[model samples]
Target: MKSTKLYFSALLCTLFLFTGCKDYVRGNGNSNDRPDIILTYPELVSMLQHYDKTRKQQFAAAVGKDEDTRINHFNLKDLKDYIAYIEKECKKKNIPLTGINFISGAYPDNYRLDPKKSNYQALIMMPATTIDGEENVSFDPFKSEKGKPLSLKEILEGYSYTSWTYDELKSRKSKKKSSRSTQKGGGNDLSPAGNRTGISPPN
Candidate 1:
């Protein structure tokens, strides 16, 4: 009887541990000032890259590249550093930020691509504080009374992006040497209907 009771209790605890947090950044939970929700760095990057490419004139002056510059920005190492910097900033501001675990945004069981660094660029619903100081947590992008929300645009205005230039990528030939197009995947996949899963059109 004792062993059986312990087994069920252990199972219940495990389930709670995994499901309760939902992969928010894990540090300094004991705070009223922390952002109820946070947008991870990669999420911001994906948003800006889309705007930079499609919006054309709007971001051209801000990003300073009028041409179609496929801003691959940083490598894996650089991304980790950037995330750390955000974490540091949150700490300084006495605000807690949450992050999520990335999963393969791909489909079709046998498709080829690295899933860890793939699509799933959707803003998640957590909690957040309004500019008026009320914790009206919602899915709407974080904003203040002052201006547009802080995101990659703010980051790019000062950020020094590393190079994965489109021209550079184009110069290299894929090892496959097959019918597959010689295009470097932007770490995303497509749906059966041929939708760009990563930068899907916003609804």
Candidate 2:
């Protein structure tokens, strides 16, 4: 009887440990225990090269050469603060903050081709949630106050981004490759390996 009781207690504890947090999905909870297959720096270079080519071919005429924003990277502190703010807001409304959705968008016509601007064509990161488990919604910040969801234009204007130029991206990739080769040849490893399970867009 004692052994059976102990086994049952252990099982209950295990279940609780796994299912205790239900705030969000994806990387959270035991439902997704498998490790994500992260892309390498080289792989990312290939992917972004393709994307850059595609973006230029598709939107160059409309947005102008080297003016259509191909990528946007955020500051770590800003991203963390934004996530925390969204979580608090969602909690107040009893909505589970499922994930952030990066929806592609364009700025207003006047700012579309400005090299000085951070958002010509950009991805708007919106907090996502499900309504009654049927319809999914991406919550737009400032929607309640302004009667319009936050636009990519507004977001870019408000927050600062440290996006890299296309030339910088190629330069970094070359440096990363060179460093890795030196490390393989028994040279001192100055930096951490780039082969990790996470998406780190060029900064």
Candidate 3:
């Protein structure tokens, strides 16, 4: 009975070891490792070039222009067309177009674009305002103040010195000097012509 019991115990130990080893292997297996094709930089550049040309053409045609305009004035339809073009190019190159992300406008009041860059591994395109007022877009101010419009002096006071032109800076400096002189009774003296006023002069 002792020998039979020892033999059964050994068999049990073997079964346990086998099950443990099987579980360990299963847990560490790489069955889901699949090959994915990625586009090279050259391929991506070519794709972008083609997409840009197509976009320009489509935009011109839709806007009723014979040729492409330097300034991009895109409406909702133009944006959709551009997105579709990018999607098609991405598919051809086996890249995920939806993964690209974009942002527009100032902080706290902007729209996000799709397929945002990850770890700085994406191409980005941003729309810019042109020299001409063709593509100018405005955002309403967050808060409106009810008062008279600020005068030129008030505007200048709030403006940065670096942003001022040479003439503007000189003008502001001259005005400041004139104000100081006036305060010191140098510009206009209110003293009586014949009598020495007892009022002390401003320091």
Candidate 4:
């Protein structure tokens, strides 16, 4: 009877170990498993290509582009910090934040006078609050027409960007894949690269 009890206990322990390993493996394959690093350069290039094909002309009309023209890239840290700051301020004023409002803005031609600035187009952001789940109001403390226009020259001072032409992106796709595989732990190598979303420019 003592030997039988020992055998049953061992069997139960083995079963529990197998169950735990199965759960661990299953968790890794689920949607909750997120990547550590940013999306690879090849991924960004593919997205840019799709955007260029579908919306380049319209974007150019709305906000002109040139070899010197630049797009704004927000730092992950800065964006998060700004959101937190806004939340804190809202809380103090007893305001509830529902979302953010992004307003399109274009710099004047004289904005080039500021050598430090790279952005020709800007997305001005403001924290928004909603009423009765219908009406939304953006909390804009800086809203004023009497004062001199704010200089956003400092806005583009810190960020870095790669200015590769469309042709360059296409050429470097395969090279980037092999090099990135060795550097990026071979993540998403099995997956297809480039715009696989079936969006194409008009022939």
Give all TM-scores, in the order shown. Answer: 0.21, 0.46, 0.17, 0.39
The TM-score leader among the candidates is 2
Instruction: Give candidates' CA RMSD values in order.
Output: 18.8, 18.7, 28.4, 20.3
lDDT agreement with native, every candidate: 0.37, 0.49, 0.34, 0.44
1-203 per-residue lDDT for model 4 (tens digits): 99999999999999998887664233367855655656889998999899878776776576444322235456666676777876765565565666666545544555554523333555556666543233344443222112221111111111122331212233335443221111222333221101111111110
The residue-level lDDT of candidate 1 at 8 comes to: 100
Give the candidate order by descending TM-score.
2, 4, 1, 3
Write one digit per residue (lDDT tens) for candidate 2, span 1-203: 99999999999999898899544556465655655767789998998898777766677666554446555666666777778987776565555666776666555555534434533566556676543232234444433222223222222323342241211233334443221111121234222101111121212
Q: Which stretches of candidate 1 lie over 4 Å from their true place?
A: 1-67, 98-130, 133-203
Pairs that collide, model 3: 99-115, 100-114, 100-115, 100-116, 101-114, 101-115, 101-116, 102-113
User: For model 2, which pairs clash?
Assistant: none
Q: Name the best candidate (by lDDT).
A: 2
Question: Deviation in angstroms for 46 in model 3?
Answer: 43
The per-candidate count of clashes, in order, stands at 6, 0, 8, 0
User: In what order do the candidates fall by lDDT, top score first?
Assistant: 2, 4, 1, 3
